[model samples]
Target: MKHKHAEPLYIKINSIDNVAIVVNNEGLPAGTVFSDGLTLIEHVPQGHKVALHDILQGQPIIRYGEVIGYAMIDIKQGSWINEAVTKMPTAPQLHELPIATNVPEPLEPLDGYTFEGYRNADGSVGTRNLLGITMSVNCVSGVVEHVAKLIERDLLPKYQNVDGVVALTHLYGCGVAIDAPAAIVPIRSIHNLAKNPNFGGEIMVISLGCEKFQPERLLKGTADTIPIKLESVDDIVTLQDEHGFKAMVDHIMRVAERHLIRLNGRQRETVPASELVVGMQCGGSDAFSGVTSNPSVGFASDLLVRCGATVMFSEVTEVRDGIHLLTPRAANQDVGQALIREMQWYDDYLAAGKVDRSANTTPGNKKGGLNNIVEKAMGSIAKSGRSAIVEVLSPGQRPTKRGLIFAATPASDFVCGAQQVVSGITVQVFTTGRGTPYGLAMVPVIKMSSRNIVAEQWFDLIDISAGDIAIGQATIDDIGWRLFKLILAVASGKKPWSDHWGLHNPLAIFNPAPVT
Candidate 1:
């Protein structure tokens, strides 16, 4: 895909920016010259920055109109600026951040948009019709997974209306300090997972009987609970009380049949787009992530909000350096402080681990042209769009208010995905530059690529390509509208490539509590 002899191109994000990224497919050679007459002193790789002007040592390297790093030595004009010579800037002091100083005026409400979905007994709606089997602890995961397979093979075909069966299995329940204050993070996550809208209304619980987390605690969640709108008591299968492994399997299958019969009666109806709960996240990111995919996602996020849908953007460490920018956009002072509260809590947690936010960046990120965590954080916040932050949630907590929300969780892709599932995202919108095959069985994931090269190479795996914004082929709004329509299509029963191929990653529950 390299530009053989086409016009040299580069992208400078802001008028004040002194560095611009190479836009050619592979890169430009040493003698390559832009139409503006800037000649590359050395070979500059695609997505890597080229100094627009000579930068003296200690001068700030700016991008997205913020200081991403500082030059370690004199950088000649047209030279490639990368990790080896850039020093990361200090994070903005949390205590000194301004609160609610730049709240955006609300966008006009977008009305009349709808999607075909199954409405649950609880006011929630589901994009998929399926039976979910939840376990009280990791001890029952093996049995539950086995039972789920048997149900799919033997019982699923009989229930014509049901889409599929999912084993909501995770590694939590008995080993650690369950009563510790921090344990609530994982405990609440497991509790809320059973209530995910895609699971329909019936919850089948399988318990090891003697695990620290009992079925009762899972069903009767904490005070911040959304009442479980069930027609009757949730069925609980105790593995310890069964006579043998086969007996355990038989008992679960019997319980699952009852749910399948009930779930089979459900049907899809046209529901307003407002019922959609969408989560946005980035994984295996790159330099173009901000300029292309993330901005497009941000645009769609705003559209979802204007249409009265609930949208959430997460990953704490990825947004830490950019918190100063977000706090000012909070709906009010209280919301702004809530954003800081979660940031402060994570700061302390990181200190205890003897690491800081700098640990968040990856080697893949550097290869993709990101120099440090500061640069990554600046890019990560682009998915938030320009909407006012309506609310903020603690780790593993669901939202009380709608619009745009910030759900705090670690930057690990799997962990963040799991927490968002527990927080009640019916459909997840994942963006990537370096690319990932990440998908979730419970929810439909619409994979978006930040660069056309990735979208073309991983064509079958990617659902949408936002890379055109990097060149001049498309505007962010155009791709954003395109993604918005694709989301509605996926919500209305269209399968993403990942789902078509049955590609999915295992759930990684966040348990910050002690193992002992």
Candidate 2:
């Protein structure tokens, strides 16, 4: 519903905030009047802030009830406030941060929520049944893609219950310092991607056999040492073992067919929402992201926790400035310390590259009214909701406990989504203000819009509209419940907008180690 107003509309997040963002679609021109009697001194773009009271140089600019930045120069009331006039604040110091000091009491448990999912042999549930062909190195990606298409064309039709084939291709496993301490990130990522519950415990590998990361090194030992056991020659197809191109293609097809036959027999069974492992992220963000989409996602995140589901929120740079806010909500001192450790590790990683968190914000972000990383971080952390953070994972490490988890990952959408897939997220929820068409072949991604304009412009791309909250058409709780129910429906095999359109982003591994 279009909200009609006699004058331009603006949104003030907190009573103490000295600035408010213009909510009118076309923005307000100079001398425009607000319902509160505040007149614009200059033209202010939609989603950009306008000063409510005079702000002297060096004084803090408050939003979301927190200091996002400080004034770089004296600002008069009704003046435009933007990135140029706002000096970014320093990140929270890690040492003196509170540990588990303000954990909220758990909400009443939400019982009996269920979805249709495929049960795996490893005691994990899968939201999709498919044959995922893992590549030992990037060299075999072309061959894997070729074989995947062949499987989809020939064998997939015969196996009616199986979804489709995906080549789990990545740019790692060779030509690099594989033994370095940081190499564990990519190594574990590949190992765990093959074991994601969505693949139904079926392990298929396509290898060149000459890569530094040999098939055995990627697979390791069977039994307790391995999460997914590979059985003999049938589980692997090696290009080196093939006499000709046709032989290589034939070998892969035979192996893929074997997995498909097994997968084809599987069927969805009623499962509780507790089996869900959801990953949340936001990209192409703007000022309204914090006010609308992220807070709604946070509320849904809390509901997931109450239902005994595992929820993870990541993007290290996006949450760095707000580390102090998270530490106090940790379930214990150890989790709090773990969070600190990840932050310190990322800080050093950035320093090694001689860049800072400022690199995280894009041109679109600034145009959408996010001044700096400090302001962006505050908005990004809103997805965690009010739940006590139960655990923290380093890059590529899978979660052991089932509640809200802080999975440390870079802010890049592809890398973070890939890392979360390795962490075993069967479904993902992505929020955006400026917008993106990001999706993963391994899981269903539900894209949400933070403003109604984008939602209306790109109607088919976005699956949900938290934009209603920003327009006063819906409350945060309304969208939160709607998202929660949609998650269950999507997990139950209802294709999301991305899936319906076949939009999938390639997997990009996070390799901090050097390439040879």
Candidate 3:
């Protein structure tokens, strides 16, 4: 005989939703029955649920004492709910979560946590040492790369500290709107590159003298900074006037030559692991992502947190689908409230344009069996592990606390990863189910997948394979340990596939207007 278990009671999620989500943790199949005072609703999966009473078409759907969504059609008690009966809802309020401080004692820390890094004059650490051929505008990108390529290959083998010459590329810089933050963008990007502990000593910036991004201003961001020798081809007025192509290339190499220092005198010191800031992200999600990769990342995140390091996760829209389970654990009321604000903002933002936020789900997600953002997010949140959310931070802001930090960012991975860098995440752990070959130009994207096909097909992009978990070959704890080692390796200068393949240009774009 098949065993049965009691269903968890679910209450109305929104004033507008007449229906409630019925959660059954015991793996109940569809069509199982449950009563909610008025009538019975059938059991859905553990993560999915629905109404037990008649719901008006526009009524809010409430669950976990919060509004998860809205009803899309008239519905009767006892009717089943899955992806079909409910609709995503909208809210008007927008703000950050309230700040709080009652955090729990952390779990165990990983043993001997360390990463090999380049020590900089400003006392910052870097994972890679690159010769930077910088440009102030789009027009000089080619010149920057040309200069980088002209350098002799064998000349740098003995310069053990240098990684390679890199050209920072972007599509904007010229034709940018005056009102846009165009002026600040290039400056910030260059400053990040120049100060990034991974860079070995200097930068040679070629400018398009007339663009919105001026060479001199770009110089100031990197101005009077430590370690990096700043070399500016300050004239943008006439390229022919500036030494021409070959001379410019020679100049870039000459700059590179001066900065290559002997690899001696560099030694690893015991920097408190708490100084480590790691970014957590998910992409190309599938059914098993939550079961495997996400939870594993969460475990690793928790381990790092225990060691006093800061672990950050974002894509607020994605995690919005399952905030109830998250809120009670919020270190304080402020964190919970900020989470609510972000959700409401997302709802209003999507509603005003008549576009469903479901539009954010990629085509591959559907093929992988994740039908909606709710299901996708439900799985995504598993990566935070079980730790007190020590703090909630604004975009580009670093975590002031030592435990787990939930940072805010628009839901784009590149944008968030870049923002993570601004937030002080020196390394990022990216999990994908269907698979994507994305890497942030500044922060390293250490890729992993829970599917064998993705791991095998994209071997060049993926660094680890959690697919073994799906086949019952490896436990989540084992994978977490494996990933812990990968993190240390990457942080210590072991190149991830993205770094090895040279896929490093990354940027963060924020929605200037409110999410709406």
Model 2 bad stretches (over 4 Å) = 1-6, 221-227
Estimate every model's Cα lDDT from 0 to 1. 0.91, 0.91, 0.64
lDDT of 1 by residue, 1-516 (tens): 543437888999988888998888888889888999899999988889999999999999988889999999999999999999999898889999999999999999999889999999778999999899988899999999999999999999999999899999899889889889898888888889998899887988899999888888877766677545444453888988999999999889988999999899999999999999999999999999999999999999999999999999999999999999999999999999999999999999999999999999999998888999998988899999999999998987888777999999898989999999999998999999998999999899999999998998998999999988987989999999999999999998999998999987888989989988
Clash count of each predicted structure: 0, 0, 27
Worst 10-residue lDDT window for candidate 1 reads 225-234
Off by over 4 Å in 3: 1-86, 89-102, 106-111, 152-155, 178-190, 219-241, 262-272, 323-356, 390-393, 397-402, 422-424, 440-443, 456-461, 468-474, 500-516
The residue-level lDDT of candidate 2 at 277 comes to: 96
Per-residue error for 358 in candidate 1, Å, reads 1.0
lDDT of 2 at 115: 99
**Candidate 2 accuracy as lDDT:** 0.91
Please report how far candidate 1 places residue 497 from its true position, in Å. 0.9
True-vs-predicted CA distance for residue 117, candidate 3, Å: 2.1
